[model samples]
Target: MRPGLTIGEFATVTHLSVRTLRRYHESGLLEPAWTDDFTGYRYYTAEQIPTAQVIHRLRQLDVPLAEVETVLSADDPRRREEVISGHLRRLEAELDRTRAAVVSLQRLLHPDPADLAVELRSVPTRTVAAVKGVVKQDDSLSWYDAAMAELDAAFPADERTGAPGGRYDNELFTHGAGMFTVFRPVRRPRATGRVEVLDLPGVDLAVTVHAGRHDDIDVTYGRLGTWVVTHALAVDGPIHETYLVGPRDTPDAAEWRTEIGWPVFRLATGTPERAAADRRR
Candidate 1:
């Protein structure tokens, strides 16, 4: 019988815990080269050390066990690389989320009043090319991407009259699913595929510019809502957002500027206290 290193000896050489080795075996990720019939002791060959190291590295990166198995089981080098690259991309996205969360937390702790600013403006009626769909709150970003891409491709820069904008139904925020509409003011509206020409009615709006990433956009919305309730009565309408500068304009997220607009009416004959009370009801 060709003798191999015991689990303990293998763990020592691989710098992996014996418990981890056992877990890897139980998960069918890395099985031992031999097992004693009487004692049931597990042993691994020196040749398997590199495989163990690879598994260890993947685990260190917090790759799911199933994905690790897929990566290791793949016979083609390109297939293995594709699997690993996919996981790495996911890790990069997670890192971005974490960084955004940290920045948001810092802002919450500091509580800067100057970060928020609200204004009132009257928008003129315009004919636009738009895409509308029912989208889940979680899927809003990707839906926006697809909708905006369609709009951009349908109308060239010369045809575009103004910045691209979106209108989100209140149900989206209140019920987690609702209609999302993206529009672009065109020199002349033309229907193409999912894009359709439509006239947007004008309305007075309480507007605010939300600068940078949307990770904490809810804070800006809260501030705008407060301003609307205090100075004006919020009317029945979807929330509007004009993308003054966006991903299509600049790759740098810090340079992005979005104008948030809440439709409203001037509060008629009431103190701020009464308006606040009425809004609460």
Candidate 2:
């Protein structure tokens, strides 16, 4: 109608729907060059076409409308690139998670028949430097990484005595939040930052090693649980995970070995009754 293009013509040129363009205008993400006062009609100059195209590209990536505005408003090319790159990194991380989920789902649909090897052992008490805290289930891995790094920094290579291990409360898995304690044996225990010296009491446990990536570690846990239910009875104690060979030891995931320990009591006498009672408890 005017010297510039109408909303419909702009949408056709940009390959964006009229509804989407209207939304962008209302959200202040993109504005028409001019609007008629009496008719309330919108008009966009040819110069605004590039802006519409840029908005279209960003929206295709599912970038937030506000972020799109920020990107468009950025004067420096590097600053605009940095903003887009940050979103790309997040998308990449999401892609990785999606791939992992696909693999897990495939394994669930077609499970491996091989049985896990489990052993019962008695552990002795020991003094160690440890860090303890409450962590959400989703944040557990990142928190563990940070805590372990702190412990490693506290004790040098020579002072470190043995492999690192962690104790996890059942509530973490059941209720999505619980206490987590990670400890490593040291030649001489001392407090540093969040780390402190503490004595861990001896306990009997049913243990199984989960090899390779943690992607299918749940399968191993299920097998270990089945073995415990049939041969022994689980007692009240935190689950212990000893990093026999972990990420620090090897870059290859196949070489990783984590010993999963479930505190247990032998079911030699009154097996059925005690087992049922324990289950009830």
Candidate 3:
């Protein structure tokens, strides 16, 4: 009945606006099958309907125009699938952050002092096999992985005395960079490559277990910090994080448990009875 589908007709069929199709053509994302030399009107083919629909779905997922073009122009199906899969992974990480934010907001709106159970402990001096570095906050995660891997290789199951832990200095959070030490408690700590035998000093700590993924670990830190300050306990040393049950031990994030130890000293101004009441509450 007609020579070809006009721009308006193609847009209506694809559920895309006339302006959007025009933009796509201008950007070389989705060019029309034909153009009239006389009137300069654009025309598309019935076969292009699928391509338009695919582009629509990709755009809906917030894929960048360049990435969408890469996906569309990919010759191999596997290559196209890889591009989509990468985008999906990014979306999943964003969803995790959003969920963590929602949980933090709910806790903030409805404060529960008892949500985090704090325990005070006096730890003795100990020796450990550790890798030390001065790293920025952004690089800390990757550095941690490499350091932990080295420690694990050094001490097999038979030699390990305790779970792997990391000691982070206050300047790490205050100045965006600081000394970080990741260590493994072992029966016989030794020096190997960057891993060295270090003597860790004794200290009093107010500790708490942060459950689940670390996406919202900052909320737990906040809660712990609040408790330490209100109970007349002053932070005294670098923060310690012991990976009791971590990703290396289990694939389930829900089962992961991290012990956050805040080094502190008790001020004599506080009443023991009041502190006991606070703990019981």
The CA lDDT of each predicted structure is: 0.89, 0.87, 0.89
Give the Cα-based TM-score of candidate 1 against the true structure: 0.84
lDDT ranking, best first: 3, 1, 2
Q: TM-score of each candidate?
A: 0.84, 0.75, 0.85
The residue-by-residue lDDT of candidate 3 on 152-222, one tens digit each, is 88889999989999999999999999999999999999999899999999877889999988877898899
Model 1, residue pairs in steric clash: none
| Backbone clash pairs in model 2 (N, Cα, C under 3 Å; residues 3+ apart or in different chains), count | 0
Root-mean-square deviation of each candidate, in angstroms?
3.7, 4.7, 4.2
Candidate 2 ranges with C-alpha deviation above 4 Å: 1-53, 76-86, 89-93, 266-281
Candidate 2 residues 136-206, lDDT tens each?
99999999999999999999889988999999999999999999999999999999899999899998788
- On TM-score, the leading prediction is 3
lDDT at residue 250 of model 1 (Cα atoms): 94
Worst 10 residues of 3 by lDDT: 266-275
